[model samples]
Structure formats: structure tokens, C-alpha cells
Target chain A: MRGVVLHGPGDVRVEDRADPRIVQPTDAIIRVTAACVCGSDLWPYRGVDKSDEPAPMGHEYVGVVEQVGDQVKTIKAGDFVVGSFFASDNTCEICQAGYQSRCVHAELIGAIGTQAQYARIPLADGTLVATPGPPDAGLVPSLLTASDVLGTGWFGAVAAEAGPGKTVAVVGDGAVGLLGVLAARQLGAERIVVFSRHADRQELATEFGATDILTERGDQGVTQLKELTGGLGAHSVIEAVGTQQSMMQAIRSTRPGGHVGYVGVAHGVALPGEELFFSGVHLHGGPAPVRRFLPELIGLIWDRTIDPGKVFDLELPLEEAAEGYRAMDERRAIKTLLRP
Target chain B: MRGVVLHGPGDVRVEDRADPRIVQPTDAIIRVTAACVCGSDLWPYRGVDKSDEPAPMGHEYVGVVEQVGDQVKTIKAGDFVVGSFFASDNTCEICQAGYQSRCVHAELIGAIGTQAQYARIPLADGTLVATPGPPDAGLVPSLLTASDVLGTGWFGAVAAEAGPGKTVAVVGDGAVGLLGVLAARQLGAERIVVFSRHADRQELATEFGATDILTERGDQGVTQLKELTGGLGAHSVIEAVGTQQSMMQAIRSTRPGGHVGYVGVAHGVALPGEELFFSGVHLHGGPAPVRRFLPELIGLIWDRTIDPGKVFDLELPLEEAAEGYRAMDERRAIKTLLRP
Candidate 1:
């Protein structure tokens, strides 16, 4: 099987790798149908997140189960399934509480490398969410997003409590941010504001139900959001960018008693306790429990209720994953999809 | 009129002050019947919170309305009332959203010195809550607590989502933390754990319905809490200490999907963004919107359902406010009530 691997900073390669096998009775081998590069993947590529050795790439995917371990009763061969970046036993106390990402027994799916022809998923019964049947070919990209970004955006909306009459502001113009705007709209938000400097991303944001778009960042962006919301700031803020500036902007752009849902992969960010304490806002986020929303999101995608696949602009064969990384790193594509 | 003034660190003097008079049409002058030294006062007295000029002390009080400006419609002469430290108009959008402390026209009652014989409360109609009648003489202390600590504790419980079957843990054992135990109990928490080193404070916490008392501090304290909750941590954590250690403990002691209500006046704490982001815990707090919970809390006090006054272990005449401050600063007294 050909898989993506990172050798060093600004270095990625797609090379032939040994095929994965079911190592545990709770494991299932899946034939990768589609995978994608994530914004988080850029962290290591940019030399921001430290990496000690060569590591596998990609955590998001939707594929068909090719083989199941003897004890894997819920999932079987030929079943199309989507799994989150964090593989969790959905029946654990943590998962039952809707925090599968923090499950007591959890593993990063990226560690197993899904950007390959085959991948091994552990705890199959809890990690995989099967569709009613084989999904339409057109739904592949959307279903793949449900494995991570789309599900993550949905978590952001829920964490921010975006609902009827809420003025929600989204910070970041990535796939997750645009999808957050879409999620807020689907959740009944009355007004959605997205901050974007790029025309292409701004257009997608507007189409995804952003009522207002501002071409500003940081303090100026917060000022614009506050001014637009009658000087009180938005009722809910979604932070998709992991930078300190984006995090602070999200907090400052929310009204007192409002909520800030931050889903960015934080790096080198230290929140001053005084400001957060005086902000009088609720904060909740992390690696989202994408497994929790997979079923609903997959249903929505199958029914054509949402077009999450719009986030994927550039596509290439699985072997061209190196080019996919370069395209996203060079800003030529908002996101890149790979077909196995 | 007379008031307590902080001449310098640990230097408090009861001095004669000019009488307060209504300067705004929305103001009301109140003759204080009971006032108390707060845990927050120790900040300045201990020099942790710097003060250059002599500043008036005390913001917690229940008093009788002595006079009202022309526009002060709801409160009048002789009406017994309680007002939070933060005065708000309650009619603003922020107030309507239940964040009266952040109201557009909010003012701190401490600015006018509620510990004085007379206080001019701004936005009287919105800031002061009248009792059913004159509160029973024995209810004065409890009513005063409602002006700050008790109300703050209630906000902590509410914000932490303390309710049936939830395990609630309190991080501080001060007047506010002790009252947080009571608030959690009142809010239907199944179990309440309080971290305390002092026997007297522990007794008060248990009397306030603490189901478990742990003397360990920091990591050990968090470990005990996690061990008690089947290694999953509590569902609701009340962080009433603003120190970094306590804040981190509160966050660490809460299970994934749990909530943290922090009302401690944060001093020099800086929360690492990475830890918070990965904690998977919801954080909400600030100077609590005590004004929002005043009516309901006052009602409970009036009905004898709660005895928050039990927290005031030392009572002194207004002239000995210096001694009162000394008692709290030295930890000789849990709380001290000053009569004016």
C-alpha cells in the first residue's frame, strides 16, 4: 500500500508501505476510499509542531471495511464507515458524556495513517459509524469531512450554543470555519458573521450563511464585530484558527455571558487569566468528539441536506498527496482531497 | 457619616466621611444596617492588590433606603433592600441577557463605600432588591451575604450546572467557597466535595452540605477528587480561588464534558491555552452577576431555607472595622460583620 509520510520539516513523501493487519480482536481493516490533508498537518510541515521521527500523515477518511476481527460484531466487511481523528470506544463513560475525544482508551487515527490504500482501525464497534448502505459517489467528499472537519465545525457551533436569534461570529476562513458558518445556520442562528480576508473563502463563507463578512484580523476584527453587534459583540464566536491572535479575537468579540467555541489546534498560546476571568464568557473546545456527530452528519450528507464537500477545492490521486500538501501550503487550495 | 478607609497595606481606619447624597435621578441613598468585610478586601490589606490613595472599603451590605432621587421609582424611604457590589440598570441588553454586572451603565457599589453609614446606590430601581417586608432582625447577616458571597456562590453553582446526580467540587473554603457548597446543595448536587485545610472552615463547609472534605492541596487534592469520582473527576467544579494552582486544579478535577464556574477575583494568573484547550472542560465565570440572582436568593433567605449568615463568625461595631479587617487578614475570623 502507498501511504503519506513526513520525513522532516517542509518534507512529505508518498511511498509504498507495508499493508496493515488486524492486530487485535477489536480491530477492523478498512480500504481507504478517500482521505484529505488537514490544516493541522501544516503545523509540522511549517516546523511549528515538533516531530522527532518520520510520521504517518492524514487522520480523516471515509472507507469500506475490508475485514473485521473476530470480536468485532457491530462492524463487518463491505460496510462503508466514517471515523473521527481520535478513535474512541464510544461506550466509555467519557464518550457517553459526549467527549469521545477524551475517552479513557483513545488513540490518534493519524498515528495509523489513513492516507493509504488500507488502514487498521481499533475498537471497531465504537470507532466506526456505518451508513444505511453504500453512499453515492457524489457524497464521498462530504462523508470524508464528517470524519473530522465537518464534525469539528458542528462541535464548534454546539459549544458556542448557536441557535435562534444568536449573532454568531466565526474567526478563520478555513474549511472548518466555513463549515462552522454552515453549521450555525443549520442550527437556526439568526445572524452569522465571518472574518475573512480572501475573496474566495469569503464567498464560500457568505454562501454558507454568513450574514456579514469583514476583511480584518485581530483587534480591528474584534472592533468590527462589536460595532456590528450594537457594541455588545456577537452572542457566539467560533475560533478555527489556532494562533493567539485568533483565540483572543474570538474571546473579545463575544458579548458578556456569550460563549466562545475554540477548535483551533493551539500552539504557544497562553491566555492571560485576568482577561478571561473578566470576559464573563463561557469557553469550551478541543479536538472535537467527531464520533458523536458522525451519524447525524452522515445522514444529512446522504439526504443532500448539506454540501460540506464544497470545502474541498483541489483533488488528486492518493499517490499525488505530496502535491496536495504543496497546493494547500502554497494557498492554491483551501483543502485537498485524495482518492485511493 | 462614617466609613472604613484603607490608608495603606494593613492600615485601615474608621474615619468620618461626608454624607452621601443622590447625584443622579436614578440614585437612592441607603442607611446601612449591616456590612461585612469580604475575602476580596484582604487582597488590598495584604498588599496583593495595590492601592495608592485611601480607598473606601466594603461592598457587601443590606440596608434601609433613607432617600431616593426623583427618578428612583421602585425603592423609597424606609424600604429594606440588598444590592450587589456591582450596580446595574438591569434594563440594558447585557442585563437582559442575565449579565447585569456587565450592564452598559454598571457601576461598582464599592466606589460609593457601602461600609459607610450612608451609601448612594446608582440605578436604584435596577440594583436594589426589596425584601418581602423588613427582613427579620436575625436575617440581616444572611441578607448581607446575599449582597456578594452567597450570590456569587449561587452564580458559581448555576454556571457550573450543578444539579441532580451531578458531583460538585469546591476548590476554596473561604466565605464564598463555603457558600458555594450550600449553593450546590440547594441546586440539587448529588455530592459536594470541599478542599480545606482549616478545621473551622471544613466544619462550615460540611454544615453547608459538603459530602466530602479533602485536606490535600493542588495535585493531591485533584487526585483525591478524581479517585472519589471513580477516576473520572467531578461533573461540576466551583473554583472560588483565583490563584493559578486553584484554577488548574478546578479544571483538572472536572471530568470531560464537566463545567467549571470560577468566581474568584483572579489576580496574576495566566492559563496556558494548550492545557485549557485540551481539558475538554467548560469554563465560565467572572465577577458574578450577583444582581441577577438577588431576588431568588433573598427569597430563600427570607423563607429560612438557607442560613448564609452563619459564615459571619465575628461581629464588630463599625468603629472597629480595622480590627474586623485584621481578623479576616490573619484568618482569625472566617468573615466579620460591621454594624454602622
Candidate 2:
């Protein structure tokens, strides 16, 4: 099987690798139809996160079940399925409480890498959601996004309590943030404000339901957000960029008693306790329980109620994995979808 | 008139002062009957919060309305009232959303020194909640607690979502934390756990409905809490101590989908964003909006349903305000009440 592997900083390669097998009775092997490079993958590719050894790369995938372990009762071969980054039992107390990402028996499927011709999924019934049937080729990209980015953005919107009567502000213009705008709009937010400097991202954000766009960054961005919301700041703020400046801006861009739903993977961010306390905002976020929202998101995609696939601005073949990583890293693409 | 003043760190004195007079159309002057030394007061008294001048001290007060400005409509002279530290207009959007402490017209009543014979309260109609009538002397202390400590604890419990079937853990055993245990009990928590090292405070916590007591601090306390909660951590955790260790312990003690409501005045605390993000817990707190809970708290106190005054184990006359501060700062008294 061919898979994407990271050898070192600025290095991504597609190489022959041993095929994944069912190691647990609850596992299922799937022939991946589509996989993509995630924003988080850039952490290692850019050397922000050091890797001591060669590491497998993608976590988002759509595939057809090729084999199922004996204990797998709900999932079977020949089914089209989508799964998120983390494999959870989906029945643990935490999972039942809607935090499957932190389930007691959780495993990071990203460690095995979904960017391969075939992948093994554990807790098959809990982690993978099967489509009604084989999805149309045109629906593959949207279905693939339900695996992580779309689910994550949906979770961020829900965590921020975005709904009718809410003025929601998004702090990033990446795929997750753009989708967060879509999620917020779908969730009925009265107004959506996005901070973006790129014209392309701004246009896409507008199409996705952003009513206001600010080119400012940091304190200036927060000021613009507050001005747009009548000096009280937005009622709901989505933080999709994991940086000190972005986090603080998101926090500051919310009104007192508002909510901040942050989904970006944190990197060296230390929140000042005094400012957070005085901000009087509810803070909730983390590795999103993408599994919890997979079923509904799949339905939305199947019904064409949303066009999340538009986030993938570039597409490449599995053998061009290195180019995909470079395009995203250099800001040439919002996201890159690779066919296996 | 006489008031308590902080000359510098470790320097408190009772001295003659000008009697307060209404300065705004919405202000009212009150004859303070009771004032208390709060745990937060110890910060400035112990040099954790520096002072530049002889600042008037005391924010919590139970008093009788001495006079009302012409525009004051809700409160009248001769009325017995209870007010929190911050005087809020109570009609702002923020106040309407149950965050009166951060109201647009909020004024710190402590700046005028409620420990004095007469103090001016801004936003009189919104800040002062009148009792049924002049209460018996025996109920004064309890009523005083409602002004700040009890209301703060109630807010913490509410923020943590303490209710039926929830397991609650309290960090810190000060007046606020002990009352948080009481609040959790009133909210029908299935079990209450409190972290405390002092025997006296521990006994008070148990009396206030702590089902479990762990005389451990920091990580050890968190470990004990998890062990007691079936290794999943408490569903709700109250953080009443504003320190890094206590904040981290509170976050670590809560389950992934749980809530942490912190009320202590934060000092020199920086929350590592990565840890907080991965913790997957909801964090909400800051200066509690005591005014939001005053009406209900006053009713409970009036009915003798809760005896929060027990936290004031030591009492002193107005002339001994310095001693009250000393006793509380040295931990010799859980709380010290002063009669002016």
C-alpha cells in the first residue's frame, strides 16, 4: 500500500508501506477512497512540533470497508464509511456526555495515518459512520470533510452556543474557521463576522455566510469586532487558530457573559488568568468530539444542505503528497484533497 | 464618621473620616451596620496586592438606608438593605444576562469604605436589595454573608452547573468554598467533596454538606478526587482559591465534560493553554455577579434555611477593624465580622 509519511521538517513523501490489518476484534480494514492533509499536519511539517522518527500523516478519511473483525457487529465489508481522527468506543461515560475525543479507551487514529491506500479502524461501530450506500463521486469530498474539519467546526459552533440572536465572530480564515462560519449560519446566528486578509478566503467566507469581514489582526481585529457588535463584542466567538495572539483576540472579541469555542490546536499559548477571569466569558474547547457529530454532518452532506467540499481548493494524486503539503504550507491552498 | 484604612502592606487602621453623601442622582447613603474582612482582603494586607495610599477598605455590607438621592426610586430612607461589593445599574444588557458585576455602570462600593459609619452606594435602585423589614440582631451576620460570600459561592455552584445527580468538588476551604459546599447541597448534588487541611475549616465544610474531605493540596488533591469519582473526576468543581495550583487542581479534578466555576480574585496566575485545551473542561468564572443572586440568597437567609454567618467565627467592634483584618490574614479566623 502507498501512504504519506513525514521524514523530517519540510519533508513529506508517498512511499510503499505494509498494509494495515485488523489487530482487534472490534477493528475493520477499509480501502481509503479519499484522504487529505490537515492544518494540524503542518505542525510537524513546519518543525513547530518535532518528530523523533518518521511519522505517518493524515487523520481524515473516507473509505469502503474491506474487512471486518469477528467482533464488529454493526460495520461490515462493502460499506462506505467516514471516521474522525480519534477512535473512541462511543459508549464511555465521557463519550455519552458528548466528549468522545476524551473517551476512556480513546486512540489517536492519526498515529496509524489515514493517508494510505488502506487503513485499520478500531472501535469500528463507534468510530465509523456508514453512508446509505456508495456515495456519488461528486459527494466524496464533502463526505470526507465530515470525518474531521466539518465535524470540528460544527463542534466549535455548538460549544460557542452560536444560534439565533447571537453575533458570532470567527478568528481564523482556514478551512475549519470557514466551515465554522457555515456551521454558525446553519445554527442560526444573526450575524457572522470573520477576520481575514486574503481576498480569496474572504470571498469564500462571504459565500459561506460571513456578514462582516475585518482585515485587521490581533488587538486591532478585536477592536473591529467590538465596533461591529456595538462596543459589546460578539456574543459567540470561534477561535480556529492556535496561537497566543489568536487566542487572546478571540477572548477579547467576546462580550461579557459570551462564549469562546476554541478548536485550533494550542501551541505555546498561556492564557493570563486575570484577563480570562475578568473577561466573564465561558471558555470551552479541545480536540472536538468529531465522532459525535459525524452522523448528522453526513446527513447534511448527503442532502446537499451544505457545500463544505468547497474548502478543498486544491486536489492531487496520492503520489503528489509532497506537493499537497507544500501548497498548504505556503498558503497556496486552503486545503488539499488527495485521491488514493 | 470612622472607617477602616490600609496605609500599606500589613498596615490597617481605624480612623476618623468624612461621612459619605450621595454624589449621583442614582446614589444612596447608607449607615453600615455590619462589615466583614474577606479572604481577598488578606491579599492586599499580606502585600500580594500593593497599595499606593491610605485606601479605604471593606466592600461587603449590611446596612440601613440613611438617605436616597432625589432620583433614587426603589430604595428609601429607613429601609434595611444588603448590597454586594459592586454597585450595578442592574438594567444594562449585561446585568439583564445575569452578570451585573460587569454592568456598564458598575461602581466598586469598596472604594468608599463600607466599613465606615456611612457609605455612598452608586446605582442605588439596582445595588441595594431591601429586606422585609428591620431584622432581628441575630440574623444580621447571616444577612451580611448574603452581600458577598454567600452570593459568590452560589454563583460558583451555578456556573459549575451543580444540580441533582452531579458530583461536586470544591477547591479551597475559605468562606466562599465552604459556602460552595452548602450551595451544592442546596442544588441537590449527589456527593460533595472538599479539599482542606485545617481541622476547623474541614469540620465547617462537613457541616455545610461536604460528603468527602481530602486534606490534600494540588495534584494529590486532584488524584484523590478522581479516585473518589470512579477515576472519571467530579462532574462539577468549584475553584474558590485564586492561585495557579488551585486553578490547575480545579481543572484537573473535573471530568472531560464537566465544569469548573472559579470565584476567587485571581493573582499572579497564568493558565497553560495546551493543558487547558486538552483538559476538555468548561471554564467560567471571575468576579462573581453577587448582585444577581442577592434576592434569592436574602430570602434563604431570612427564612433561616442557611446559616452562612457561621463562617464568621470571630467578631470585633469598628474600633478593632485592624484586629479583624489581622485575625483573617493570619488564618486565625475563617471570617471576621465588624460592627460599625
Candidate 3:
């Protein structure tokens, strides 16, 4: 089987690998129908995160189950499904509390590596949510999004308490941040603000119901947000970029007693406790428990209530995986979908 | 009028001062019935927070309104009231949102120096909540507690989301921390764990309904809490000390998706964003908006539903304010109440 592998920094390649098989009773083998390069993948590609040996790449996927182990009861062969980046045993106490990312026996599906022809997923019954049927070709990218980004954006909005009469500000213009604007609108936020400097992304943000677009960054961005919010700052701030500057902007843009839902994976940042304390804002975010919102997101995708698939501006065949990674890394594509 | 003044570290003295008069249309003059030294006072007393000159000390007080400006409508002369350490116009967006500490026009009473016999309170109509009537002498301490410590502890419990079926861990054994235990119990927490090493404070914590008392500090304290909570950590953790160790312990002791309500004034602590992001916990705290809880807390005190006054282990006349400060500094008393 052929799969995406990274030999070193900026060294993505499609290489032949041994086919995956169900090795545990709780595992299921899925034939990857669609996969994508995530924003997080740039860390290693840009040499920010070092890798010693060749590593498997993708985590987001929508696929058809090709095989199942003896203990997998809910998922079966030939079933169409969408699974989260992390595999969680839904029966665990943490998962039952709606925090699947912290499940007692959770496993990172990317380590198993979903950017391949066939992949074995652990805790199949809990990790994979079966779709109604084989989705149309047009519905592929949106369902693939539910596997991670869309579900994460929805969770971020919910965590920030973005709902009716609330003004929400999103701190990043990546695919996840764009989807956050959509989620905030769908959640009934009265005003949506997206911080974007790019003309193309700004148009998409407007289409997602963003009422305001600020071209500024950092402190200036906060100042603009306050100016638009009657000088009190937004009721909710979504932090989709995990950097010191972005985090500070998100925190500062939120009004006192307001919520900041941050889903960005923090690379290397430290928050001063004194500033956070004096800010008097509620802070709640982490590795989003995407599993908690997958069911609803899948429904929305099926009913055509949202079209998050617009984020996939570039597509490539599995054999041309390297180009897909290059395009996303160069900002030539918002998201790149790969057809297996 | 006489007031407590700190000439420098270890230089607390009661000195004659000019009587306070309403300085603003929204101000009210109060004759302080009771004032106390707070844990925060030790900051400047120990010279951690420098003061260039002899500064007035004390922020917690319960008093009788002696005069009111034309704009003061809700309160009047002769009314007994308990006010927060910070004055806030309750109708502001931030105050209405329950973060009066961050109110746009908030005034720090202590910074303005409130230990004087006669103190001027700004935003009087919004900051002071009057009791039903003149209360029995025994209610003085409890009402004074409500002015700051008890209200702060209650806010911590509410911010941490302590409630029925949840396990709560309190990370400081000071007056506010002990009161947090009482607040957790009143809020219906099933299991309350308090980390305390002092024998007297531990006993008081137990009396306040701490089902488990861990004498360990830092990581060990978190381990003890987790051991008692079936290895999953507490559902709610209240951080009453603003040090890095206490903050880390509070964060580590809370389960994923749990809440940490920290009300301790952060001295010099930095929170690593990566760890917090992976912890998947909700964090909220600050100088508590005590005014928001004043009415209910007053009712609880008047009806004897709670007895937070037990926190004051020593009492002295206004003339001996120096001894009151010394007693608290020497750890001979949890709290000291000075009567005028």
C-alpha cells in the first residue's frame, strides 16, 4: 500500500508501505477515501517540530470500513464513517463527561497514520461515527472536515459560549478559524468578527456571516475589536492560532466576564498569571473533544445546513501528496484534500 | 478620626487623621464599625509590594453609613452596610455581567486607603448593600467576613462550578480557603478535600465540612487528592493562594473538563500555555466581584445559614491596630478584627 510519509523537514513523499491489518479486538481497518494536510502538519514541515525518522502524516479522514476485529460490534465492513483525530473508548469516565480527548485509554489516530490506502483504527466502535450512506462526491470534503476541523471549530464556539446576542471574534484566518465564524453564526451570535489580512479569506469569512473583518494584528487587533464592541470588547473570542501574540490578542479582545475559547495547539507559549487574573475573563480551551460534537456536525453536513467543504480549495490524487503539503505550507491553498 | 497607617514594613500604627467626607456625587461617608488586616496586606507589610510613604492600610470593613452625597439613592446615613473592597457602579455592562471587580469606574478602596475611622466610598449606590437592619453584636464578624473573604470564597466556589455529586479540592488554608470549604458544602458538593498543614487551620477546615484533609503540598497534594477521588482528580478546585505552587496544585488536581476558580491575587506566577491547553480544564478567577454576592451573603449571615465569622480568631480595639497586624503577620491568628 502507498501512504504519505515525511522523511525530514519539507520532505513529504508518497511511499510504498506494508498494508495495515486489524491487530486488536477493538480495531477496524478502513480504506481511506479522502484525507487532508492539517494546519498542525506545518510544524514538522517547517522544522519547528523535529522528527528523527520517517513519520506517517494525516489524521483527518472519511473512509469506508474494509474490515473489523471480533470485538468491534457497532462498526462493520463496507460502512461509510467519519472518525476523530483521537480514538477514544466512549465508555471511559472522561469520555462520558464529553472530553474524549482526555479519554482514559485514548490514542492519537495520526500516530496510526490515516494518510494511507488502508488504516487500522483502535476503539473503532467509539471513534468512528457511521454516516447515513455513501455520501455524494460533493459531500466528501465537508464530511472529512467533521473528522476534525469543523468539529473542533464547533467545540471552540460552544466553549466560548457564543450564542444569541453575543459578539464573537475569531483570532485566526486558517480553515479552523474560518469554520469558527460559521459555527458562531449558526450558534446565533449576533455579531461575528474575523481577523484576516488576505482578500480571498476575508471574502469566505464574509460568506460565513462575519459582520466585521479587521486587518490588524496583535494589540491593534484588540483595539479594533474594542472599538467595534463599544469599547468593552467582544462577548466571546475564539483563539484558533496557538502562539503568544495570537493568544494575547484573543484574551485582550474579550470583555471582562466574557469567554475565550482557544483550540489552537500551543506550540511554545507562557501566559502571565497576573495579566490573565486582572483581565477577569473566563479561559477554557484545549485539545478540543471533537467527538462530543461529531454527531451534530455529521447531521448538519448531511442536511446541507452548512458547507464547510469550501475550505478545501485544492485537491490532489494520493500519489501527488507532496504537492498538497507544499501548497498548504505556501498558503497557496486553505486546505488540500487528497483522493485515494 | 484615627486610622491604621503603615509607615513601612513592620511599621503599622494607629494615627489621628482628618475625617472623611463625600468627595463625589456618588460617594458616601461611612464610620467603620469593624476593619481587619487581610492576607493581601502582608504583601506591602513584608515590603514585597513597595510603598514610598506611610500608606493607609486595610480594605475589608463593615460599617454604618454616616453621610451620603446627593447621588446616593439606594443607601443613606444611619444605614448599616457591607461593601466590597472595590467600589463599582453595578449597572455597568461588566458589573451586570457579574465582574464588578473589572467595572469601568472601579475604585480600589484600600488603594485609596479605607482603614480610617471615617471612609469615603465611591459609587455608593452600586457598591454598598445594606443589611435588613442593625444586627446583633454577634453578627458583626460574619458581616465583616462577607465584606471580602466569605464573598470571595463563595465566588470561587461558584466559578469552580462546585455542586451536587462533585468532588471539590481547595488549595489554600487561609481564611478565604477555609471559607471556600464552607461554600462548597453549602453548594452541595459531596466530597470536599482541603490541603492544609497547620493543625489549627486543618481542624477549622474539617469543621467546615472538608471530608478529606491532605497535609501535603504541591504535586504530593495533587496526588493525595487524586487518590481520594478514584485517580481522576476533583471535579472542582478552588485556588485561594496566588503562588505558582498553589496554582499548579489546583490545576493538576482538577479532572479534564473540570473547573478551577482562583481568587487569590497573583503575586508573580506564570502559567505555561502548552500544559494548560492539554489539561482541558476551565480557568476563571480574579479579585472577586464581592458586591454581586453581597445581598445573598448578608442574608445567609443574618439568618445564621453560615458562620464565616469563625475565621477571625483574634479581636482588638482600633487603638491596637498595630498588634492586630503583628498577630496576623506572626501566624498567631488566621484573621484579626479591629473595633472602633
DockQ metric for all predictions: 0.89, 0.91, 0.91
Worst 10 residues of 2 chain A by lDDT: A223-232
Residue range B1-340, candidate 3, lDDT tens digits: 8998999998998898878877899999998999888889988998888989989888898889999999889999999999999999999999999889889999998975667688899999999999999989999999999989999999999999999999999999999999999999999999999999899999999999999899999999888888898889999999998999999999999999999999998989999999999999999999999999999999999999999999999999988988888898899999999887
Cα lDDT of model 3 by residue, A29-62, tens digit: 9999999989998899888899899999899999
TM-score of chain B of each: 0.99, 0.99, 0.98
What does the interface RMSD come to for each candidate?
A: 0.7, 0.6, 0.7
* lDDT digits (tens) for residues B242-293 of candidate 2: 9999999999999998999999888889999999999999999988899999
Worst lDDT run of 10 residues, candidate 1 chain B, spans B108-117
- Model no. 3, DockQ: 0.91
Model 3: residues with Cα > 4 Å off, grouped in runs: none
* Cα distance off (Å), candidate 3, residue B88: 0.7
Name the regions of candidate 2 deviating beyond 4 angstroms. none
Error of 1 at A64 (Å): 0.5
DockQ-derived CAPRI band for the predicted complex in model 2 = high
Please provide, for model 2 over A1-340, each residue's C-alpha lDDT reduced to its tens digit, 9 standing for 90 to 100: 9999999999898999999988999999999999999999999999999989999989999999999999998999999999978999999999999999999999998998989899999999889999999999999999999889998888889989999999999999999999999999999999999999999999999999999999999999988887787788999999999999999999999989999999999999999999999999999999999999998999999999998999999999999999999999999999999999
